[model samples]
Every structure is written in C-alpha cells, then in structure tokens.
Target: MDHDVVLAVDIGGTKISAGLVGADGQVHRQSEVATPATRPLLEEAMRGLLTSVADGASPRAIGLASAGPVDPPRGRVSPVNITAWRDFPLLDLVGAIMPGVPSVLVGDGIAAALGEHWLGAGRGVEAMLGIVVSTGVGGGLVLNGEAYAGPSGNAGHIGHVVADPAGPLCSCGATGCVEAYASGPSMVRWAQSQGWTGPDARALSADAARGDAVALAAFDRGAQALARGIAATAALCDLDRVVIGGGVSAAGEVLFAPLRKHLDGFLTLGYVRRLTVVPFELGRSAGLLGAARSALPTAQFESPTPA
Candidate 1:
C-alpha cells in the first residue's frame, strides 16, 4: 500500500474537517462541514465529506483527531461539547466507511502536537506540550520524543485540571477548571459579568486593546488562569516547550504577555525556570497534520514503546 498520502480528519465540537494529506504535511484537498449534535446526522455528514475527499485516490490509511475524552484503545468517544456522539465507536465507524484500511483515533490536542512535532514548531524537541486555547482549553504532550497517550487515551486533558477552587463552573460539571476561566466563551462571560457590554471575546479583546478597564481585567483574569495551568503542567511533566494555539490565542501579546508574567511568578525552581511558551507554528492545520502522523508506521520509533 502506498503510504505517500493519508486521509486525515479533524473532528471538533464546532466543525468536522477532512483532508487528503501528503507525506510532506501539505493537505492536497480539504473540506469542512458544520458539526451537528445528533449521532446519525453527524455520521452521515462525516461519511459524505470523506467520500467526496476520497474520490478515487483510496488513501493508504485514515487518521482521526477528535475532541475528547476519546477511548483511543477502543476508538470510542465520550460526550463532547458540540456533538451527541456519546460513547461513539469512531474507529469502527471510519473503518466501515473506508473498508479495509487501518484507522487510528487521537485527541485533537494530541494530533496538534504530532503535527507540530513533524512539520511545525515542536520539530526537534524531546518533550513538548501543544495547547489549544480556543472555545475551550485542550492539550497534548510529546514526552521523551513520543506522544504520551496514557491509559484510556485521556491523558492530555489539561483543561479539566482545576486552577482555582472558587472560579466559574466548567461545562464538564467541574468548578474552577482552567477552561471555566480561560476559554473564549468564558473570557466573554467574565467580561460581561464585569459590566462590559460586549458581544463576545472579539469585542472584549478590542475593548481591551482600547484600554477599557473591565476588558483588560477580564483578559488578565483569563491569562492568569492559563498561566497557573501551564505552570502546573510544567512542574508535573518537566515539559521543555509549550506551544499555544487556537482561536483565543489570537489575542496575541494581549493574552501572552500576562501569561508569561504570571507563569514566572508561579514557577519556583530554576530547572523549570527556562520553560518556553510560544505560539503554535502550524495554526489550524496542526490537528490534521498531527492526525496523519498517528497513521505513520510505528517502526519510526526504534524502541518498542507505546506513544
């Protein structure tokens, strides 16, 4: 079978993105569809898009990057924010659609890390963390030169880690989760609660850029929460680099400047004092590229170890 190209699909809460990705990490053709909450409809939509992209090339394998908590071992997905794909057998479904080709499932953040590791910023790093700070916070880790998907495939769920005991409630039914205070929607909510009249995060960011006191405070709050989470992750894992991506990261220095300041205050040891946080290099394509990396031969790593 030709391994020159693979079918890569990135299924997020808001959209399902499919592409024919070549070995060079370039997507030759791509399509996107809005995600629906129902299982049957969502499945049908995914099938249609895949079929269209597949055409006659018949890719060697299929790679999927999905919003979790996904059971990668079994290729099953749990409840996600946008879709009603509870306990959905994703690998089985994709296999049925593609027939005999092997398919692999991974979390979106994991996929992003893989993409960055192969074709983006995490290229030469032995240890790195890829984070998506968009509508919600998500993360994937590459430890000791390999993706570290823990038991049950839920290992890189950095967003659910509690950063504040009394912060806002997260959609995951947890209070003070990092996502509750740092996600795009959460930032908008915080700004609104501060009596700033804004439609969403974009408007709030604009207001902050204009020196609106409440908007600036809201951004600071979110950045502080993110800094706390990053520091905890660095301390726990000894990560060498942190690559931040996604929609909210578009806030640029407005968000990152404060995050760096707060991260410095949180770290105590000199060993981890040099941890670097940088913007993700691949942008939106990171997930698809990372998904494709998952389908590459495991032999790429000489040691017989699970990643």
Candidate 2:
C-alpha cells in the first residue's frame, strides 16, 4: 500500500527541526538548523531543509509544530521567548514555500502530546498530558482521544500557570510562573542566586547527585514548583497520566521522585490518586513526530507511497 508523505517541521526558540515523514510515523530523512532570530533567515533555513528532504519523495502536506501562542487558524507564530516572531505568518510562509501543499499548524507542546499518543508513551490512552521541562515548561493535553488546543491556540502554555505567586519574575513578565522556577536554565539561575555557582543544569544535577546541599536545595525547589503546576493541571483537567520530557527531565528519578512526592500531598481525592507521571518515550523526536502525526488522522496510519 502506498501512503502519502508529509514535510514535518518543529520550531522552538533555540532550534528548528525538519523531516520527511511517511504516514506510518517514521522520519525517513531529517535536518536540523539553528533557529534564526529573524523571520526571513528562519524561513530560508526551513526552505532549505524542506528542499533537501523533498529530493526523494513528494509530500502532500506540511505539518508544523511551533512555540506558542500560534494562530493556528492563520498559521502565524506569536512566541513570547523568540522576539523576532510577533504574529509572524508562519503557515502562509510555509504554504508559499511549498505551493499547493495543505498545511496544519499546532503548538509544540500539543504536537508533542499527539506525537506521544501516536508513537510514544501515551499510545492508547484517552487522557494524558505531555510536559516539556526544557528551557521553559510547556504542556499539551490529550483529552477524550483528541489533542486539546484551547481557543486562541494557546491551550498548553502551562508554564505560565502560577505555581508560586511570589516566585521569580518570568519572561512572560508574570510572577510565579512554573517556568520561572522549574525550567532547566531557570533552575541554574535559581541555584546561582543561592550562591551555588553551578554553570548549567547538567552540573547542578551532578552536584545534586553527589549530595551537594545547595544543588539539592535548588532541585528540590524546582521539583516543588513543577509539582505545583502539574497538580493544578491535574486538578483542573483530571489528567490520567503525564509524560515528562525535555533536557531537564534527563535528571530522571532525581526529578520525578520529588515531583511525585509533592503531587501526592497536593492531591485531595480520586483524581489525584489515579494520576500517573511517566518519562517521555520519544526524547527529542517527540516534537517532530508529533508535528507529523498532526498531519494524519488521529489514532491511525496509512502506508507511504514509493519514492
């Protein structure tokens, strides 16, 4: 059986990833490029990636996973962290780059959830959350067997949800956002503010593993902040499971154990007791695969056509 292929692009504040994906959820060919600060340079880089992957197979559609708040209806990006893009018409740009191809745009967090649902840990689940604890905290929801993109396409900006009303100021200019305390870089910054002097999240994690008091304290604070955020989401959405991903999540049990402990105390009843937190199954590929998965019908696959 022949399946239609799609060009899948995942754009974050720091990087841009592109791939040629068959309907079966496999990324047959891919490329990564530094995300340009400016829109034109970013678009050029994406065009180059698409052209490179188009060498062997013609794609019927384009699937994009971008940082929010993206105008899914218009396919434009309004990312808070990436300053150059303010309501940038991303969907139109990609459509123009590959004329006649149908395009679908989704938030990276939501895309991650869809990706996990199709090929990762969330498979067969009717309700779940995909959380990315990287440079910032972002999340997406799969509720009732569909990806939930709230009105305005900003449904999963869970990072902005206030976990500590008096916590550090966030890039969003808000106080107490989960990202302000729990993001990888934010954890490092918090540690520095505490006079720990760790250079990065990796070093901090290492020091914590060695039982460094300051490092452990910093990680504990981060874990608590993340737990607060997750608990809030679980309370509101009644999530059955959560899949945590991104660089910070690499801390493994160092992070999860504390998160679980904190969440347990925060929960009040049946919903709280049933929520399960797990590691993300696809690692870095979740965003790209999720973007590709968004292009297909949910929960099923079609074979790809021969090149």
Candidate 3:
C-alpha cells in the first residue's frame, strides 16, 4: 500500500519547495522552483509545483511553512526577503489547490525548530531553540516537547534579542539586535567596514577558515553576539539545547569555536550553563518535515523526560 502522506511546502525568499512526507518524516516525492519576483507568478508557480509533487494523490492534510513574519492563525505571511508578498493569503492558496484537506500554517523558523525537535539534533531534548543565521537570523522554540508558536506565531524570534545597547541597527528598525551582528550580511558588512573586502558571507567564511585575521575577527564578533543571544534565550526559557543552521552556520568551527567560548562566559547559572549547542541535523529538509509533522492529525512529540 502507498504510504499516507501530507503535502508539505516550504516557501522561502529564493525558493519554493514542496514534498509529500509521511508521518515518519520520510519524503516520498519532492520538487522545487525559484521563487518568482511577482505575486501572480509566485502563485502560479506554487500551484504548478504542488500539483506536480502531489501527482493526483490526495494528501491527508497540508502543511505550509513560510518565512516570517507570518500569521499562522490567519494563514497569512509577510516575509521581508520576499517583498512581493505582504500579508499574502498563503493558506487560501493551499486550500484552493486541495479543497477540503485540513491544513496548518507556520513560520519557517517555527517549522525548523519543530523539525529539529521531532527528528533532528533536538530529538530527545525537552526544551530547545532552533536558529537560522543567514542574510537574516530567525529562531523558534520547542518547549516541553511541543512547538510554541505563541499568539502571533512569532514566539521564538531570538534574532531580535538584544546583544548590545550600542550595536548596529537591525532591519527591524531596532538597535543591538543579535541579527545586527550575527547575520551573514551583518558579518560581511562589519568585515567590509574594517577594510576586509570579501564578496559575501561565503567568501568571508572561506577566508576565516584560512586564518585571515580580519575574517576571523568578523566571525568572532558575530559569534559573540550569537552566544549572547543564545545565553539570553536559554536563561529565559531554561532550554536544554540549541540547534543552529542557515548559511552562516556552515562556517563550522570558524563560528562554533568562538560561540562556544563566549557562551561559556555568559552562561554563569548552573542550569543555563548546562545548555548544549549543536548544528542542525536535517538542514534544508527540516522545514518540509516539520510542516508534515504539523499536518499529522494527532502528532505530538512526547518527551522522554518527565513533565
């Protein structure tokens, strides 16, 4: 018999990916396309992708994972990178594509965290934070083995956590946000300001790996800011682990080494000090799988630890 699956879609600034996923987090079919610059084209692409991936198979449900800022309850999204979509009716599109199928909408950050909690590095952890550090930093929470999307579906926005009172301005019009320092663009911009000319975060990461002083320093600064953000989130939530991903995270030890060093200094409390940080295991697949998990009618991640 064919495996029962949900239609899972992950919509991002650059790409729109769709997959048919089973309850066990296995993807049976998948496809992706570049996100169009216009809303009409985007809608058309999404419709075609969904239809192709589904292949006439009626999904048990639908899971839509969208980049924030998202209104999950209302199935609307306004991703900063995707300027064409402001308060876009994403779920309505899903509904129109597959009428009568139950659907769940979640922020991409939340989906990443839920994916990690369900099957990735956070599998056994009771409370954890999953963060994405790229052109922008985003985060989501899994508390007591349950995804906590909060009232606005923006609960674990750790990127906005303040790291310094006198730091650079963030895209969110705030000063000293972790994103102002740790995001890929922020790191590259800071490196450039210091006379370290690199094309992008990828180049910076390469140079940092080669022991270039300026590149290393950039990573160090970004790492410190990320450490502060992680520590703050851990303290506030009493977290057990943190899973980091996105483009900047691929810097590996260039980022992780400094982050670990700085995190130790910030996490002084005994409980908080025990917080462990790890790389995201599922990578890009996390969002799709997490969305599928959300669509599961009775899905719940029961913690091995006692409540």
User: Where does candidate 3 clash, by residue pair?
Assistant: none
TM-score between candidate 3 and the true structure: 0.92
Give the lowest summed-lDDT range of ten residues in model 3. Answer: 298-307
Model 1 per-residue lDDT at 44: 96
Q: Write the per-residue lDDT of candidate 2 for residues 1-307, one digit (tens) a residue.
A: 1236778898887788988887777788888888888767877887887777776666777889998878998778887767888989987888777887788899999998888988899998888889888877888999998889888777867889999898889988899999998988889998998899879999998898888888888788998998888888888888888998988889887888888888888877775679999998999899899998787653122453332
Can you write out model 3's per-residue Cα lDDT over 1-307, one digit (the tens) per residue?
0337788998877678999987677899999999899999999999999989988676778888888889987889998768899999998988898788788998888998999898899998889999988767888999998999999998898888899979988887789999899988889999999999889999999999999999999999999999998998899999999999887899899999999999989999999988999999998888888888878863232322112
Q: Highest lDDT among the candidates is held by which one?
A: 3
* Per-residue alpha-carbon lDDT of candidate 1 for residues 1-307, written as tens digits (9 for 90 to 100): 1245789999887678998876666788889898877888998998899999888776877889998889888889874465488888988889888898788899988998889888889999988889988777889999998999787776777888899989778998889998898888898998887788889888887888888999888889988988888888888899889998888888888888888989989988787888999998988889988998887662122223233
- Output the TM-score of candidate 1: 0.92
Whole-model lDDT per candidate: 0.84, 0.83, 0.87
After superposition of all CA atoms, the RMSD between model 1 and the true structure is 3.5
Q: Using Cα atoms with residue i matched to residue i, what is each candidate's TM-score against the true structure?
A: 0.92, 0.92, 0.92
